[model samples]
Target chain A: MKKQYWTEYESKVADDHYYYERSCIRQSFFTGSEEVFINIVRDLLGKDIADDMNLHTCSGIGYYSGVVPLDTTMTVVARLFALMTEAGYKNFVPSCITSFGLVNEVVDMWHHFPEKLEQIRGYLKEANGKEFDVPENIAHPCDIIYKYRKELKEKMKYSLTNVHTGKPLKVVEHIGCHYAKIFPRQVKGGAEFPQVLVGMIQEWGGEVVDYPERRHCCGFGFSQYMVLANRGYSAANSKKKLESMQPFKPDFILANCPGCTMFMDRWQYTIAETEGITYGENGMGIPVLTYEELAAILLGYNPWDVGLQTHQVQVEPLLDKMGIKYDPKDKYVGKSGAFLGEPEKPTHLKVKAYE
Target chain B: MAELLDMISADIRYIDGLKACMNCGVCTAICPAAEFYNYDPRDVCNTLMSKDEVAIAELLKTDKIWHCGQCLSCKTRCPRGNVPGLLISLLREVSIRMGYFTESEEGRRQYAIKKTLGEHIVDSGYCVHVMHVKPHLHPEQGPVWEWYFKNSEEVADRQGGNYNKEGSGALRKISEESLKDLRKIFEVTGGKDFFEQIDRQSKKKASELKKNITDNVDDNEYFYHVYREKNETQE
Candidate 1:
């Protein structure tokens, strides 16, 4: 028997409802991106989306990091599916690229080995006393957005072209490893050259820049970075990517995975702070944005309102290029629009406005 | 020795990751861990194929398996279709199961990951929650994150997350019934067993090393010892 993989896009946008599964890292690092996703789906796309509190983390990090075993990881995924079934959701949208990959991988695994599926079913029965119907439609928000790029582009208040220069912004797209690498055919483009992110960037009027290390991992390496001692391995890889992309002079980076986004964003700061070396022009790092964040920006959401203020690398340079209007005073303000008092700006940030 | 080799051969990850090694250095050339650490995936595959039980056992007891970032970059480039990343996963599993994980400095730190992420999942329903990722614990989250941690609830609220409140939004309180079901799933799926085994093995290691062992995951001296131990060579 030949090894079979998904060759076509297998997911569709939920016409009416979607059970939005949260990614642990995304909610933790880019809190506003999830909200922006919800806004785009619910308020903009006119879909009734529910980010259920019942949905647990996919434990992708734990499992991939080798702390959690595969069987346990599958069961946890099975339990989440059961929760989705209980919630009466037939369409699934994952917030994290890693979670998206895990869910797809588990579903495909169960498909290939019915015995394992039955084993997980038996476990689910023992645990919840319920049977789960696998979601009919499952997609990462990126996929959903990719599918509706035309509609999104139509709804956009801003394009990816620089407002000042009137030229398309040079954007680099970093696809998470789990997004397509695990199951290449499942993604829009095969793993070798994925276009899921490129589709979004192009549709939003940005020039997608391909660099030498375009396929490099963001170095989250879960355990490699999580354990402080092993962080050098993670940092080294990120440094490699920074060095690879430095020549491109990308105005910004758009990542589909929260881990990738966080790492690509955070590790630049880490590399510069620890190693005293920086990438990109003028020793200022390229700003990294989650796909949802870029979407929020294109849809005219305030930069500060979308939590760009929380980024270690100042997003002001990109915002200025895009001519996005945001108040510096409002950046540190509370939910009720009250100023929370400013944090002493770190010296690493080269942007005078942010400093 | 035959039994140990059988265990390796039987593991699906091992089966999936290895086809036939031609001693190709592609896996190492592309390996991020190899670039920094004294680790090589080609050597790992070569040793596993050697089927020497002592060498395999020694490999498990060393920090070598831990060095794999599990990026699966090896899977992408392997001309023989071998996945050294997956091979690492299987080795790590067997090491933990056999208590060989406690034999190395890096391997002993598995307990810290087990306690932090393992307990975080079972208790909080999420592997990482905003509340649990304290600024003090994760200084890499930086000063803004420190502020966010202090004003997390408000920040969550502003971002349209439900935080700890009840409703259909991010970080909302997972229902007790659902949490119960989650716990049951863990129980039935052997997740609890896996965690307990890690704890038991680590405790035994701690006893041998003359470190204090406590039932409480947080208060356990061994847990804190590994968790806070910084690499002298980190810089």
Candidate 2:
């Protein structure tokens, strides 16, 4: 019996030994996303990778937010859910940086917060009737894919191959704060400005342009922006990011997570309006694209087909610059609650945890 | 003055100060707190200014207020110097009063960062600014601390300023002392003792965790090793 419908990403995880963790918050926000990444990784890396996967909610993220507490053992047990994905496997990947850091944080601090860790261990023991060994190795999705960048580049069937135009295409990198700050060490390919995404982009033939405030948070801290005028602050951060990259003349600003993509892309126009910052057609007012979107484009997929035009700012110039033909109808309709079909699942999807 | 003070005294001292911000968003761009967390400093300013109690109240329910790293990076850079970071401090104060984020685990963790580093500054007449080599160069952050706690004068000299000169650099001590007072407002306001206990636990727990991490840290420590080795090789 063939599986009814899993994202192409599942194929890669199944074949590639994809790493991941399950996040409670993400599971709550969009349950389909983790499932999408999971199924995709399983399909790609072969079932063995999923067998070794453990996606779970990070232990302490919500506690600091004062939302979830130390006693909120559900988040920790959620790790067991991911472990069950691979039957209590070795290190799995976490897509969400926060989940990655917080899970590791709980494990690392368990020796110190013995009671907190033990409480979590106890819950997992009773509830799942299973034990977890916080594996010695773990990594964020970016850190993992970054390790195989050369292989990804070699296996490329797409023509983002021309994005650099035989000359290095200018691009700026935004490393999520949780990725850098949570567990600065688990990040292999080295830490301290690990350049996981940027290195991958460079390997794919794009220049990883360094902008000031490169490692600044994407302003998603607990979705404060959604709750208030964090829009202004997010917009402001976007300006700082865009302004910093102005000198470098990057063709596009690339974001990693969905939150950063939303703020950087949506808030740029608003930030520009409020701050009185000017933008030329192909200038400082650039659009933000995620690596998934970037990868889709790098593979020479149709811009609208992959939702490029869904961007708030006009992404035409970059396409025009790249000489990539774009579908006119691909433009995102007004944000008046119009369904643009489901957001395209990124091909070569990386499995993750809130892990 | 009555109206302004009325706004200020209305349980949240930042109400008046926050109103001064036009929501220009300049503060958010420069805030180091926003750099690490998903918070927008300007949003706190905007929320305080909105006078829309429900929105403000709903927002206060989150722990984002505690995410403020309080580097004063936003304060220095605000076009009006409005200090959204400080405004968030006021929010935390109000949240404490309202019992929103009182004694949060993160706050407890922060309390430790402050008690260990902060208490020492209050007692020692110095801040971490003077002690420790540039954080990037110091791996353990202890040796440089041990040395610079005594020899900070050389760093002061290098910066072309004598902090001990009562008329010039010493003036900073006044603000530092006052800062201790301002923070006391945060400490003693509502759940001060609760904050203290969490701070204690966090400091104890954090140090223990750091020891374990450091003990297990592989041959490659942090960027400190890379920088030092690279500098030596370059030289």
Candidate 3:
């Protein structure tokens, strides 16, 4: 039976031009995912987008993690808006989910207190000698894709069905906390049950598996994970999600936020190593893919070409299930199409002979 | 004294996070951090409600305020419309401003983040740059990352990123003029003062702890002490 879904807000479409602001964690942890997003938007969808070098980090991590103050964080975000305004772009599309939330929150804050907005404008003019008009539309890349899921599906070279099994792949979606929790009304499908990811899964021909703890955090709690002692909190929370989802036997986990994606992917390995236990079938952890990576695969892009090799959890099992052809030998190859020396076999995976 | 109340009232987050606390413990029930540690957002709100200066000061100096993940889950679940997450933000701000951050082990580690992410934004215009993420520092990135780091320029170019290039694309170099404006924004927005406050408090704590204080956060003994210190506790 198809689970019921409803979205409180309508998704925004970028149409053509987007002022792309990159995420800090996404660039460092999953550089390839960002690459895949730009390629799909430019090469596949043929949309005009500008990734401005002048835009600064949203400073969300520094503020939320308790190091940078709120005022500074807001000011930094205002400066980014100024950069976008200067570039003559109004459609704000942030690469990071946290930045998307921060922008929304700052805009809301400014609305409630126009004085604060005036204060930020004063500071920006004094500092950079410029002013900015607030963006007419601010959307996450996932939201943009969600708005155009039907178009993407029409252009898709592959579906989410397993090529050999002739059945839909069972997929689970994890939404980041900041994506909807702060302002539930702004998100598609509200916070209790978000359909932003589900819309993509459905359009791509995948069965969305319902599981307990679906709304729980991926536990990238900046300080919670950064502090070694507090990592148990992260592990414990992830363990809850893993155990709850293990019963459904999901083929893969899909995430929108880069931080959540990295944490869910990497922490599965950590939990397996530390606890001497593992989730998923045959004790091999379920692969976690960012929404963009999933989009790239569904579009028939090579898994290794999209940089799946860098994942802590191997994605070969999923590729094998989908009957996707990729050269394992090229997984670690450099951009120059040269071998980067063989990577030492990952400790978690059992040895297998090459065909 | 009324000064504590005055401090809380000065910030809008405090005003928003604290309402009449009904003490329902719903925030605690929904808190992810509370499950792992002895953290309770309800308790934080309760204590702040006491309006006691000594208690407020003590709360600022302890590791409690740092425990919140700032996921704002409490904001979502709180029936009374109170947001403990925002209260925690206000507490953290006050703590750093007053040098109370050095009083706790978790609080002291603010230096590490300040040096890495806080400084990275001003220096590079990006919080987490490709070259700055050392493999040794983030071993979870695994062996593939080491290779990528060595061949980053080539890989980035092939992947459509204009990394370190002087043009518009992913990870492109920010012009010197823009960088100057960024630094000026910090100065005008009080971000520079906030960073200086963290440095001054860290230096003072280093002297008190008899650790060598240096001009650079990377070289300072106090910085290393906080960054390298490990908590032996495990769940």
Candidate 2 lDDT over B198-221, as tens digits, reads 444443444543522121213323
Q: Model 3 RMSD to the real structure?
A: 2.7
Looking at candidate 3 chain A, the ten consecutive residues that score lowest on lDDT are A346-355
Cα lDDT of candidate 2 equals 0.46
Poorly placed runs, candidate 3 (over 4 Å): A1-7, A12-16, A349-355, B1-3, B215-220, B230-235
The weakest ten consecutive residues by lDDT in model 2 chain B span B226-235
Q: Classify candidate 2 by CAPRI docking class.
A: incorrect
lDDT of 3 by residue, B100-207 (tens): 999998898887778867888789877777787776555655555676677777666555667787876666776777778878878888889999999899888888
lDDT for each residue of candidate 1 in A275-295, tens digit (9 for 90 to 100): 767665566778999888899
The top-ranked prediction according to DockQ is: 1
| Local accuracy by lDDT, each model | 0.80, 0.46, 0.80
TM-score of 2: 0.52
Using all chains and alpha carbons, the TM-scores for the candidates as numbered come to 0.92, 0.52, 0.94
lDDT at residue A113 of model 2 (Cα atoms): 53
Query: Alpha carbon lDDT of residue B93, candidate 1?
Result: 86
Candidate 1 C-alpha error for residue B220, in Å:
5.4
List clashing residue pairs in candidate 3.
A7-A189
Give the higher-TM-score candidate: 2 or 3.
3
Q: Which segments of candidate 1 are over 4 A away from where they belong?
A: A1-17, A280-283, A351-355, B1-3, B213-221, B228-235
Of 1 and 2, the candidate ranking higher by DockQ: 1
